[model samples]
Target chain A: MLDAVILTGLTLGAIVLGLLFIMALLSPLEALTWWAGWTSHAPSPGKLSEEVREEIEAQADRRREVGARPRFYLVYLTAIGGVSAEELSYRERVFLETLTEALPEAVIISDVYPFSVTNNPLTGERMLGWLWRKIHEKRKTITGGILATFIFARNLFNVAVSADPRYGPINNAGVAREIAKSLYRHDYPLAGDIPVVIMGWSGGGQIAVGVAPFLCLGLDAPIYVVSIGGVLTDDPGIAFVEHLWHLQGDKDHFHLISDILFPGRWPFIKNSAWNRFKRAGKMTVITPGPMSHTGKGDYFDSNAILPNGQTFVERTVEIIRDAVRTIQPPPPTSIEEELEELLGRGA
Target chain B: MLNNSLRSLMAISPELQHALLVLFLAILSLLFGNSVVLFANRVSRSQFIRSLLAFAFLFLLTFLFWTLSVQALSAMVFGVHKPFVDVFIIVSQSFTPFILGFLILLPHLGHYLYALLRVWVVINLIIHVAHAYDFGSAQALVVSLLGWLLLELATSLSFLKLDAVKRWFLKIATGKAEYRDPNDLVMAYVRAQRALMLQAAQQQEGRDA
Candidate 1:
């Protein structure tokens, strides 16, 4: 009886430890599921909490009353969200707050998804939700653990297989369409002519730029993109953007992987398309020396004194505001003139 | 199959001898995974008669920066009474493990292979440093590690365009020959941001009034 009890205790302890390990590994996935559920329920700014929605509406009304032309609709897309606005990653939260303070009249919509796992309209679950449910529902049995492991392995395989010709741009475009529809439905009464600016940090930057062409077509509005250390691809959607301001830190080695993988940014390539974009005054790339991949470093730190008297965070905030101001529509050119210019240019 | 083809080519052509030599060097450089040996040779030959020379020269220049950086750090830390040429030769030979770098060309296993190769190279470097300087294993390890740290800093600085070559590139690109100040770019970004914020605030205040 004593031996049996000891064996049972040891087995139970091992099982508990194993479960804890799995949970720790899948914590991000679990958080993603919760965020998906939250976002699915509140698809748009209108569906946000009554108090938050009312506050935004009141602000828009005030702006309208003041006859502010070209009302700005700013959408802040989070990267694989589990954290709320209050609990946003330090840099992300700082960026959102800075934007809010800079563009007081702008309607800022946060927590917009760039992709979903299920085709379900009401509960558009993300990849995390499927993984979370697989583990949570059958967690008591050994098969449950096996199933979770299988799912994780399968996801890894899928990621490896789909690395090239990435589906992110397509999925992000879909999210952009949804956002445009939401903005149109919500702000039609308050402001009809809305200039949609989509801002994303890191992977979210890929989504933000991906949404540009879709947002432009869906809303018929001028689109601006602010990418912060974004792992961007050479997507044709960039052509639709009025202005794209890319902020990178010199220390952000991870973000530079895109350039290595895609040689479009290579300086030796004559008539590089991105260079043309820069020359045309459509794209601006800024490398803030002291910033890190996650906006850590002197640029994001409040107490860090830069060579200039200003703090790094203050400098970053200034850059963000400048990027926002560069979102004006391109100067009008006649169709004949455009045709002549195009014909005049040689490949 | 590659070895067989190379053997057949060697039998067929006497005129292709120099070309074959260049090809061998190219392959050697690739196996070494850096430009140190290739660059030293290319610099000795002034004018490039072949395209391979140009390629080797570029790689050599790139590799020289890293090797030179390591040598400087090693000299500083170890206080080794060795000529720069001897230091360079040992340091170049230390990259023997990187011949396995080609394993990183394989998909899915690249990350693992590259990581393993890095460890192997570091171990080789420690051993080489110990042998070359007649230092104890522990002392060699300390010297190698400090030198590596400096090399890492140099590599990162190169990537950040703080290095002389990259700074020159920046000057050429911008058409503004400015001082190589690290904070210059950061300050510009900050200035733009401040101006934008000020403008926004002024506009907001004006509307309120």
Candidate 2:
């Protein structure tokens, strides 16, 4: 009887021990996943799996059907004193990389600094860096908020010149001359028409828009320019902005915050004018959440129209492709048109 | 499959382990899941989640005291049943040596605040073992001997052993390797909290100029 009692005690003890072991392992403290990253997509997405594959395949087919396999050159522009946009997180990096794969070649990176074989004659350090530094420092010094009224007034004066039909394009002509001087050491050099994607972040955007005369002049063919987290002064004309797309994060108050604090063309910029104009085009503006300008990952995740977790990467590709396509006005075959056609009143 | 394994791993804990699990869950849920609690202070949701998890895991394993008064209660109030006695002995024995093991491993994980508790547990175990040896206690001898041997073996394998872990060590040494959030919620939380202040400072500078 004593032996039986001892055995029962040991068995109960072991059961309790097992229970304790299980409980201890479940401790709430260890669930943190810091050294982790976002996954692209699981191997399967369940019942609608075929649909997803079909859609992806159809998109690829469309790209091929359009003569030249369309290229998506996303030149990510960065802020003043910023590092290469390549530092984008694994998730954002994957998006850009994947987008590049679908195109003819991967995105050709052009840093606001001298990131390319694009040669310059004047300073020899590459005017990209020369122009980039001046603007960034200016933004750094410019006052934020209403206190920047003096700078704002100076912006108005500059805007007047750009806005003027008489001298604006003329000044652009002078800019073209300077660019020619810089490129050829005396005269404008010939540049073949390869599509250009000019990306800028913060003050880099200012330079990207301002220096349009340099890039657009003497171009042999239509070029596509894209801006992200940037500000544009005016309609850089139908030529530069015809196929232009601007991206900004919704929660990214960086651009918005900059506008609120130093609204006009302070830091030598007057991009607020273009904001309204571009809005008219109804282009995609992604919204992640209420904006903060912390980083590109935030910018990627931020969407005005897109829900928080949706892919801005794919949507960006489609917008660029649409912009570069043949421009045709929408046909008047709306619901109203259908009724009219039924009544034989179609225009 | 991985999710199932993690869930099962997390679920199979005793009361103390359960507490650590709760801390982990709370951290992830509050920071990543709800996010309401994170922004309450300078700390972010991620940081809050991490710190609480560390607190829960570290606290339960090292700090809770076993007293003479408790032993007296076990003997008198509940009639000091054999099963209860056995459970008390196993739980207490299991915890002490593991706590010592954690202390041995803590320094390698980097200088988080929880490392202090880890060292504390090790020192306590060493002292207990020595006391056990002086009194010729068999349980103390076994636990201390096993704990010390395991500690020595782990250290040697990590350091002296080359081919097996060289790649991992190199990555870690250069900070190329990522570690699960080692209670770094404090820094992340603090950084997020400071964003508004920087904005305000910029504004103030603008006004002053």
Candidate 3:
């Protein structure tokens, strides 16, 4: 009887352990954290709050009075876990603030998308309710562990298929659409034609490239991309951008593995469509030595001596300023000129 | 040892040779581990034929791991896709080069010949993998290197441990038992080889004197 009882207990324990293992494998916490990190730069007090928005508008109006073109700099912050830019940790906020201060001419606007749904000041039950609604609207069933396993497997299969711009879970298209809508929205007024520059850091670089084609089509202006230690798959849509500057540190081992994971980025591989687009001068790759994957250490310090005398940050800033200055606006075309040219060709 | 055994078997009668072949197959099946054959026999409710077939299939599958590793590494790294069974067949057939392992019975020169055959087998493996997976020369070279690393790890973990197990059995049978750790046995073998080489050199010097 004792043996039988022990055997039964062991069997039950094994079943419980198996179930727990499956539950742990299918937990959404990791995916949630990654998404949260990706969209942590969502516009905060400056864009979301009414007082800050009015103050920015007043500043822009004053700048416009000085005959300056209303230049909008939309910077995508590097990965950090926060609902919005307002809630970003002290260090992250300071970094973005410093960047904004450096670009004194342009009106700086920044936001995180697709994950902006998580941008709420509330806590506990309110956040849970918000998450529940978002999941419910997406028609995702997360009640049981078995269903979660199926969802996870499906995501794995999708990643294996391409890891392209159409990766479903991230909803790159939806994010692009949302950004386009925000840019066109009447509330945030801008004078004259808006010259917008889109920039992202780390994983945000992939998001920037994914959204560039959409921004180019919607905004009717040139789009420039700056990717720093970013993981990006070769997508033909990147051709729509005026120029893409990929700045990577030579010591960045993590960034190098991105090429292995996403084979489209491998330069030597032939017969890839992305490689053709890359060879067309649309993409410029710069490997600045003595730089870490995270632009930290000697790379981040302004006084740090480099082989080229200039510090890493100084070189990076110079490259970015040069890229911005080299943006040539599209020449105007009139209907009369077009008709005359066509008539002359026919003659 | 395999060549000597085969030569001795050839001097026997025809009927004895047939029986010996069956016994050899049976022993081979046992050496491969009877668990798979027993499982097959239990599940199928068949005679010895099912077990024999299962043994053959399992033996072939071992070689298939080499091809699968190459294919998987290529697919993951270069996004090259190929049929699994096609690779398996080519890899299994490429095992012909390893038949030179029997040459180990040819005394001192046998070891050199066997080492050469191993390199030939690796070349055959690389060719087969490249053909089956439709990889370019450079990609195939990378796949072969990675496949070799995978095969070496698998071999050390599984097959190489059998030598230590055999040594343990011999030690017990001879009653010359020494408490030797299995992990340290590799170093012991290296030391033995060095001693043998030194003895050979001293003998050569004495002969000259």
Among these predictions, the greatest lDDT belongs to 1
In CAPRI terms, model 3 is classed as incorrect
lDDT of 3 by residue, A1-347 (tens): 99999999999779866754443332222222322232333222111233323433444445445565445555553432223434444444544555566666665555543232232321223424464334333433445433334323322322221123212222333344345444533222222135566665555566567566545543344677777666565654566667788877777665665677655667787545457667777778777666675524322445545786976666656666666666665554333443344335431
Residues B58-175 of candidate 1: C-alpha lDDT, one tens digit per residue: 4465445545655665577666566555655665566665556544433233445667867886787789878877888887777667655755686687456546664465344433
Please give, for residues B1-209, the per-residue lDDT of candidate 3 as tens digits. Answer: 99998898798766555534543443353323222212211222242344445445544455556667866887899987666655555555555555444333221233355567667867776786678677777777788778767766865786568447544643444332233331133223222322332233334335546
**Model 2 DockQ vs. reference:** 0.01
Candidate 2 TM-score restricted to chain A:
0.40
Model 1 Cα lDDT, one tens digit per residue, A1-347: 99999999999779866764444333222212322233243222112233323433444456555444435777775543212222355665666676678777677776454433211221224545555555646645997755545433333322221121223232343355456445634453221235677776665666676667556543445788877666665554566678887878777775666666545556565465555566678877887656776534734566666788876667777787776765554444333443333334420
What's the C-alpha lDDT at position A67 in model 3? 60
lDDT over C-alpha atoms for residue B147 of model 3: 73
Question: Residues B56-135, candidate 2, lDDT per residue (tens digit)?
Answer: 44334222323232233334543442343333333344344232222221111112323554455445544543352342
Per-residue lDDT of A240 in model 1: 69
Which regions of candidate 1 are displaced past 4 Å? A1-70, A80-87, A115-169, A185-193, A267-276, A298-300, A329-347, B1-209
Name the best candidate (by DockQ). 1
How do the residues A89-135 of candidate 2 rate in per-residue lDDT, one tens digit apiece?
Answer: 34445545554554543244432231111112112343244543344
What lDDT does the true structure give each of the candidates? 0.51, 0.37, 0.49
Calculate DockQ per candidate and list them. Answer: 0.01, 0.01, 0.01
Can you give the lDDT of residue A339 in candidate 2?
28
Q: Rank the candidates by TM-score, best first.
A: 1, 3, 2
What candidate 3 gets wrong by more than 4 Å, as runs, is A1-67, A80-83, A89-95, A113-165, A168-170, A181-193, A268-273, A298-312, A332-347, B1-209
